[model samples]
Target: MPTTPISPPPIDRTGRWLASLTQWVLAHKRLVAVAWLVLTLAGFYGSAKVTGALDENFTMPNSASTVTNERIVSRFDSGGGTPPLVAVVTLPPGTTASAPAVRADLRALEQDLARAVPGARIASFGSTSEPAYVSDDGRTTFAVLHPPSSVVGDNGPSGSEIDEETVARAAQAAADARVGGAEVRLTGNALLTSEAAGESGPAFLSETLLAGVGALIVLVFVFASALALVPLLMAIVSIPVTLLAVWGLTALTEVNIVVVFLVSLIGLGVAIDYALLVVMRWREERERGLSNEQAIVHAAGTAGRAVLFSGTTVAIGLLAALVLPVPFLRSMGIGGLLIPLASVAVALTLLPVVLATVGPFADARRLRRTDRAERHWAAWARLVIRHRIAATLAGAALLVALCVAAQGILLGSPEARSLGGTGAPKAALQQLERSGIGAAPLAPVEVLTPADRAADTAARLAAVDGVRAASAPEGAWRADGQAVVEVLTRSDTNSQAGRATIGALRDAAATLPATTIGGSTAQTIDFVDAVYGSFPLMLALISIVTFVLLARAFRSIVLPAKAIAMNLLSVFATWGVMTLVWQHGVGTELLFGVGPDGAVQAWAPVIVFAFIYGLSMDYEVFILARMREEYDRTGSTDEAVVRGMAGTGRLVTSAALIVFLAFASMATAGDRDLQVLATGLAAGVLLDALVVRSLLVPATVSWLGRWNWWMPERGRRLLRLPAVTPATES
Candidate 1:
């Protein structure tokens, strides 16, 4: 019989398209590189100016608290929206707050503060002469200064109108003028935040530099060549381009201040990650004896495609935030969505061009052998496959335990003690606590009422179960046919009892007409309800969309389901770790010099969930895509699992470490919310790479065998993907 040569399989549409695009990039290497350089320069400028545009507005539209706040701010110039800056004055031991000279000094101090801070409304022992303004011992009196409200469209008040430094200086000078020695200290949400952030918190640039250094170290260990620097360069280019996009976004809508940190840090990690995947795969192809151009195309057809899928999943995860009613979070989603897409663009377009020109030259000066890393990973994969059931069970058990710990997570503001500051703000708060005033003054409930019924409403609110006292102060509290009643709770509003007190007050106010509650605690409660109430729907939408995308990428129904399940477990595990470390104060004191906060900041969990779910999916896509390739090439599921792990295990591990280091750098921030977010993301990356991807995924794939590659006809038709035939059937 004459020899009949077998033909190679035809290239799929996606692979063919990637190969052509890679060729085109290689042809115009210089032009692509120059384009990215121009965008990067613009990005540097955008990043610098973007911060000024960010606003921390947490208002929920159409919510009861939001409606009440708008009306109050409109009617009374100072009552509802802005948190008051409290100035505490303690007279000498012999001089009571009621002393003639002391009252005169307090009145003078209030007038000075009003003069110093334009649009400020002051209420104190001098302004109202209410007994509630004085401490039990009658030596301490505090004045509440409500800063001016300037609501700019839907973004709420543009922060505090009065400057903290100005308030402090004026109050101090007036108190010093008193005949009896008197001391003044300022304490409030704004002042405490500034004090806690004093010089220790890292800026976006410094944090990016720190993360870059950490990533450099990991890259050197992995590549052991001048090529280790290539990914960093790609990141340098990717970050600024993403920021430029964000800058453009700012022109259209409001972007959250937090987006700056996320773009710098998360953008750095993701850009470098995509570059690392493509570069490593190209190097592997070259080592296998492909020509330079051939290697680039092959890498693009495989690893480049994986990067596309990964970036899309990340974008999808962040897009889930758009479902939220809160404007800032939705803006965060839009900002975060730009990050991965920009990175993918750089990796796919700019990266291949750079590699085609200088890759071989840069990779030649190797400090260590590359094969050693692969051999170690291969050996580990074999061991895992040998005990597949045990590996699966162990990984599941560990993740389950972490999920249990997450059950204790409470979503609210941190307690007063948890606020970071060792300066004047801390001392003032402590002094107020010692004076038997406690945090009640810090979080008073403001009720907007009909002017005629003000006193009656105050009396009715005072009898509420958790009400400590209620006062309808005269001057600033009454305006425009409406009166403001300030109600003090027995406990701090962030506390459980305080939350209960707010609920009781709301219920009691429900029976009263044209009466509504508006204050910090009420606003916070509305925020929590608005964000979390829709969370289940958001989760379902993300899950469904992600499942469909993964199914099309993997061409396997079972595999996508498994990947989604694993990613969810990874997210919950990360949350559990955050709960223990931050909420329960496990190692928090030793690490951050702060004690247990008893609750995670209300915004941290949702942001963490969005980032982790998508980032974790990246690993799943990387590993399984390679496994699918190996399965198609070979005729055994065992061989596919082993080969897949051996190929992608090291790459996934290195990428995870790079990302974790980037997020970990955020812990240096003085803000507790950022620290919590950083902890959750860093922990999630490690847990996913080490546990979920390493052991559980390979073990489960191996155990599932032929079934792992099966896709139903209906799914194939819906996805417009070819039916997957298992190696065993072939």
Candidate 2:
């Protein structure tokens, strides 16, 4: 037999560290196991605090609206950040509000509402005696409910508005109005935000359970033994630990309520994935005939190294959120970042100990077995390697087509029409609008100035484009020698036209000293600018940091670069799918029980991007790291690609499916933003695993051949990596 070429020792510091960690974990298996259990118990104890601290309100600090609200709070002790809830009171056809019978009914209705929700200060035609509160047609009028600022706590004024129970009750109280042959209905920023957030808690719970069940099933298929339970156990432990860490974070800063859903759903997927990668590697090492201890060490050196780098990539992708300048988004980033880091910690330490103690029992039963080479994946990989250019071009063409479809996406806050037509609020708003009384500005723009300038400022604003009306009623709102003028727009304040109008008014107000514009519309402009203004920098930071870390892991220059490039393509493709489904309304109505809005929700894109970038890398690292390992042993690019696929193909697909299920469950919340987010993540995982990771990546690597592993001698030395000659065609 020909002598085998001697393989060089691993010079990678990361790998050595991982190997050392595995040894320590294995040596103290019992102690590590007990410590993890205690940590998990602590997490359960802290989860309630995290839950209580979450707030859904979106705020842009130092924005026009924020400054205006602060001034109102400090001076008038009112009009902080409360969006007015509109109670549409419409008389029966042929009836008018002036009718004595109608007036009596209106008064009773007002009393009923006050009795129903005592805390929100109720302002209506019955309570205020203001002609403007009623429609010019005399058949319709409205009441405005102001949510108390104190209930919002220290997070901010907007926080009170998103309290699902509070808003739902307000809407219900309005819907229950039945006096004076008139029907009462509620539709406003407060109600709309409530409807979206109301279902999040139950939906998140459902998604977590669904994902858990799905993961167990997938693990069974992959392992075909009790060993499938190993990852699940790790997930149970890791999820709680991550939650506990997030809870501690909340004590020091504002955390978004949305982060709870993200941590639970996304965290579940990531935890199991880390465990799966480690378990699969351990199994492979065992099959190679190494002792249990030696196998754990070798698996840790290879798969553990990948998990460490992959976790960093996942965390780095989420770090982009910290650049957005919104505390809620930043909290989401922090919450998301914790999942991978916590999972990595568990995987490197607790996981090996479990493998050393409980893993053998689970692995003992093997109803289905893996061979030295997984025949199906090997054949498919060989097929792609042989026809590499065609595979690469086909995948690229599909991605390009998807990107083109995404180009027409519209982005804005949801319109009344987009909130769906089934709710009581929807029915009321629609009825009022048909009679030419559109949903009035529930969140009116506030123009603040000296008391003397109030009338002049109001008159000037009334003349501006898109202003339906402006008023500075005497004694209406005054404090600290300052006056407040309310300006109503022709469009719903959160709509695109409304935001455009707000921008123009801001430009006009520049000439007026000490006059500030504040409302939902003005805040939308600031929120978008603050987040997107810094996105390019965030993208660069994530990509650069990830590339360096991945390069160190693979010990090659080309692999990490190619991996990053492919991930961007996948992300764009995902956005295309989101745009098509949500913005374009391709299949939303029939599938999700909601009609397509013309625009995606304001905050969905950045959150989705941050999560998708990291999640996509999770699968990318798992597959490519295995390929890198194979290439070092075989020194043949084609063989390495084929064998790596054979080894990791099922595991990657299973992991992707698990994550997809987790995100897909979010659609069940019956909220448009949740649906869009679910669609983006679910579609991204499918395309990434099936198209990018499965086809494009392998084909690209095969076409590049030995060049895929190339590094200059100087570069190799700088990174302190082992020497390797590039392999030529056999």
Best by TM-score: 1
How far off is residue 629 in model 1, in Å? Answer: 1.4
RMSD of candidate 1 to the true fold? Answer: 4.1
Task: Give candidate 1 misplaced runs (Cα > 4 Å).
Answer: 1-11, 45-58, 89-118, 125-131, 135-141, 150-162, 170-184, 197-199
- Decoy 1 TM-score against native: 0.92
What is candidate 1's CA lDDT for residue 585?
A: 90
What TM-score would each prediction reach against the true structure? 0.92, 0.88
RMSD of each: 4.1, 4.5
Query: Per-residue lDDT for 1-730 in model 1, tens only?
Result: 2112222123456766777777777777778888888898998898787778776665667889878877878876665656677778677787788887778877887887777666666778876777667788988778777766642222222223235565466446444544246667777766565555422587768888999999999999989999999999999988888888988888899888788899899998899989999999999989999777788888888888899989999999999999999888898999999999999999899989888789999998899798887888788888888999999999999999999999988777766666666666677678777887777676678898888998899889989997877878887678888888888887887777888899999998988988989887787788788899999999999999998988888888899899989999999998899889878899887877777777777777888999999898888989998888888888678888888888888899999999999998988865666777888889999999999999999999988988898888888899998655546733
**C-alpha lDDT values of all predictions:** 0.81, 0.76
What is the C-alpha lDDT profile of model 2 across 1-730, one tens digit per residue? 2212222226266777778767767667778889999999998887766788776567778877778877865665445555666778778778777777766766776666666655445555564455546677777877665555554333222332535566677767766767566668877765554453333445566778877898888888888899999888888888888889888887888878788788888888888889999899899878888777777777788788878888888998987788887888888898889999999999899888888877878899898666633888999999999999999999999998998877765565556566654476677677657656565556777777788888788878878898776766544366677887777777766666777778878877777878888755566567778777888988899888888887777777898899888888888888888888777788976777566666766577777788888988888888888888788778888988998899888888888988887887777665556777888888998999999989998899999988888787887887777776666555
Error of 2 at 677 (Å): 3.1
